[model samples]
Target: MSYSKQKNKIRLNLVIALIVISLFSISAGAKTLTDLADRKLSLPDKIERIVAIGPGALRMVVYLEAENMVVGVEEFEKRNQQRPYIIAHPELTKLPVIGPQFGGDAELIAAQNPDLIISSYLSQAEMNNLQAKTSIPVISINDGSPGSMTEAELKMALKFLAEILNKNDRAEELINIFDQHKNELKSRTSNLDLGMNVYIGGIGNKGAQGITSTEANYPPFEYLGLNNIIEDDKKSNFTISKERLLLENPELIFIDQGGIELVEQDLKREEFKYLKAYQENEIYQLLPYNHYTTNFATMLANSYFIAETLYPEAFKMLEAKEKANQIYKQFVGQPVYSEMAEIFGGFKKMKLN
Candidate 1:
């Protein structure tokens, strides 16, 4: 072979080798994340822009103080202003709408050009399908149901998302605050044997319902060791019949402000006046904690208010509204208790004539 030809062949081989190394480097840069669905995903090392889909997904992102990274949101989030996270970060609503609700529109999500997509309560197949459709790395985290999510499950989700967003310190801070509040609540009322039967009505399931709508095992009652009139093994929201409510006849009644108006309308009937709670004027109003999904911070605030109401001596030092604002600030980066109170009536007693 001619000397010039041999040199050209060597140059070509070097160029090919360099291309292979570059390809390997690019592959090595990606990190593998094992999502809650138990699916393995190769995500970009630096995820700058993201989109959160499904119920409680965006809320979790906001909890981790990573809302700035979100480039788009579900259409419902823009329309609904009840959620504390959304209320705290109104700018999120201004972002591009990805889709209507629940799972987002794949084409719209793709158009946002996000580096990653975070989802909640989605099955493995669904996450895989979304990733395939959008050609974006998708990670699923389980946030269980609102008001029913275990603390461990919530912490796991927060830590996972925090790790992904490089907000580990924030995760720790949140977890600690949650623990402190839970412990304080338990300690306050653990020994109290509140024999009086209590009931919370006007609980919103899908939309607002009347006084018949309630939770079988209300979390605030469980936290405060108060006796909830309704008892079931399954901790879920369901409507009870008026006849059954009359039979149970709780001594103390608490109405969820979400359905307070409906509850008040129901009270106009003389039959409701026969109940012990009505006769003694024991009915009180509580802020709605189940807006959108679980307003976890609001739930905690509700627990404080419930405790203060049931055993005033136990919580004499505590100011319910002030405590609520502090909790709202810790969870959502803003004190949203006043805004929430204004939307749904603030904590107070119901006037039953």
Candidate 2:
């Protein structure tokens, strides 16, 4: 062969090899959706900074064990803010104003210079607009239904997070742990005769309506083997009137933070002071764990607390504080059990008349 022709052939092979390498890089780093309606979600080369815009996303971050990666959150995203898992972390509370949970300050989110944005459900227009304007990718996961969140959805979300954080083994371990606790709780309380007259009061300040006394929001109460007394009583979601609460006269009432405030306000009124929940003290306040009701971790915590409160003898096999510590350390990855206990302490031993 001519020397010039041979040299040209060698150069052509080098160009082809370079092209193949480029294609491989693109494929290996491609973004993907983990579930339904999920967009082209993929992890950055390394997710050193992230902005979690919803409570569900916060739960995902906690499960991924990426608490330190979170750079921002929605206005109402509660958790380690006051005394968080990481000391000196920026509190979303004092951060610049976002319009609301769904509508945060886009400019501020950009300013945070996050590698990825994790969100739950956002309106289509909002999501699309943000994607177009921002260089960072926004990945969303479903929050499941209000009737009850499914284990399937939780698993799916966790898997996506695991892929992003490169913690597949830890994610699987968390799921296994979650399933173990769930099965144990279900089995232990399966035959407890958890009769009717269980009520969950008031929505949160951010407008989370509590569980329907009926089948509408059945997951949490149903999980615990309790019947929500107000499920069918009201057609719409709102705070139950004193008359309704008095009439239902639930055996147990779970008062949310907002509901607790409302009831406290009403107690000043002579008329509402004598209601069954009030007089009997059957109400249990649900402290805000991550700004919303009932995630997997919160549900487990709530279940243990409620089980001890309802069937003390059965749960007497284990100490409640120990149970709390186990959940905090194993699941939440934060073993500040004493601090969490203090925050949740008020709800533990309150008498419900």
Candidate 3:
């Protein structure tokens, strides 16, 4: 071959190489995102399809206004239950179950060919393991554990999701709603001379617990500046015996919807007859906070309801369900108050004779 011919061929090959590099650059514009576990992930710029695992992962996605992008859901959410969001977004139940609860099926997840995975309530190890097993970038969210409700943690998760989903405006709006209402609650109750010893029962941790189950630092009680009758432990859910109930004789009582049946059963017992709250038919019902993991909207709604129950004069104009729907609209982009009201008879006074 002549030198001129060889040089021409070399120039053509160089041009081809340059085009390949440019094409590669166009495809490598993927960015890195940090999950709630603080793990760094390299992800594609456009995330159109998603699968969420762990506890309440889908719920968090729904709050982000990205539930339509979800390609799969956990089996638990697929069940025909009355969780507010579940009822609002019935189409989600039709999707394939990624796995039962937190135990994800990697094969199923990969089959969906999701661009991203959102896993809630998972440790760093479990998150990384799932990410590796499925070869999909996973974002972990912390929305508190079983019966523990932490606003700061939930805010962090919301902000993190907003960043990933590019929904900063919506995130800010939701955050503002949370802060504004929480401040309202604090301002209303901060300096009050609280004397009414309030007792909350039927607090569900794992599932529908008995009436004896309760929490030490119940969020709504803490917000309302009222004294929770049981201050013995700092645990989330612990059963205080009926004997203790008789000894304390709390001024007011509230039951979680999850354990309403158990509460009614306990009310039938002669042992509970002497309790002042029950005897006066002063038992009120509140939404279940732990069902399908912490429903942040319900938690805030219940807080408002508790505040009203504690100080009727202040919240006389504000109906609890109305306030709850406002919170729900801000958080989930819809007025879900009616569904919640239908679900377990939300935040109503129990009038059993």
lDDT of each: 0.83, 0.58, 0.77
Query: Which candidate comes out best when scored by TM-score?
Result: 1
The residue ranges of model 2 lying beyond 4 angstroms of the native Cα positions read 1-29, 34-36, 41-48, 71-103, 143-151, 203-220, 232-238, 268-278, 289-295, 349-353
TM-scores of all candidate predictions against the true structure: 0.87, 0.73, 0.86
Worst 10 residues of 1 by lDDT: 17-26
Give the clash count for each candidate: 0, 9, 0
Global lDDT of model 3: 0.77
Cα lDDT for residue 50, model 3? 92
> What TM value does model 3 have?
0.86
Instruction: Please write out the lDDT profile of model 3 over residues 20-115, one tens digit for every residue.
Output: 233222236786655556666777788899988876777778787888898988788887456767776888899988877875788888889999
Write the residue-wise lDDT of candidate 2 on 1-353 in tens digits: 34795687467545533432332223476644443343444456667888776446666777677777777766654434433232123444554443356546678788778888777666545566776677777766563333233565676667656666677798779877886776677677887886546766654434444422223344456666776676653332344556676666666666544344454555567654565656666767654432443345555666677777777887889665667568767766765556644654434534432
Our model 2 lands, by Cα RMSD against the true structure, at: 13.5
Q: What value does the lDDT take at residue 289 in candidate 1? A: 73
**Any idea how many clashes model 2 has?**
9
Estimate, for each residue in 292-313, the C-alpha lDDT of model 1 and write its tens digit.
5566788889999998898899
- Ranking the candidates on lDDT from highest down gives 1, 3, 2
Model 3 regions lying over 4 Å from their true place? 1-28, 143-147
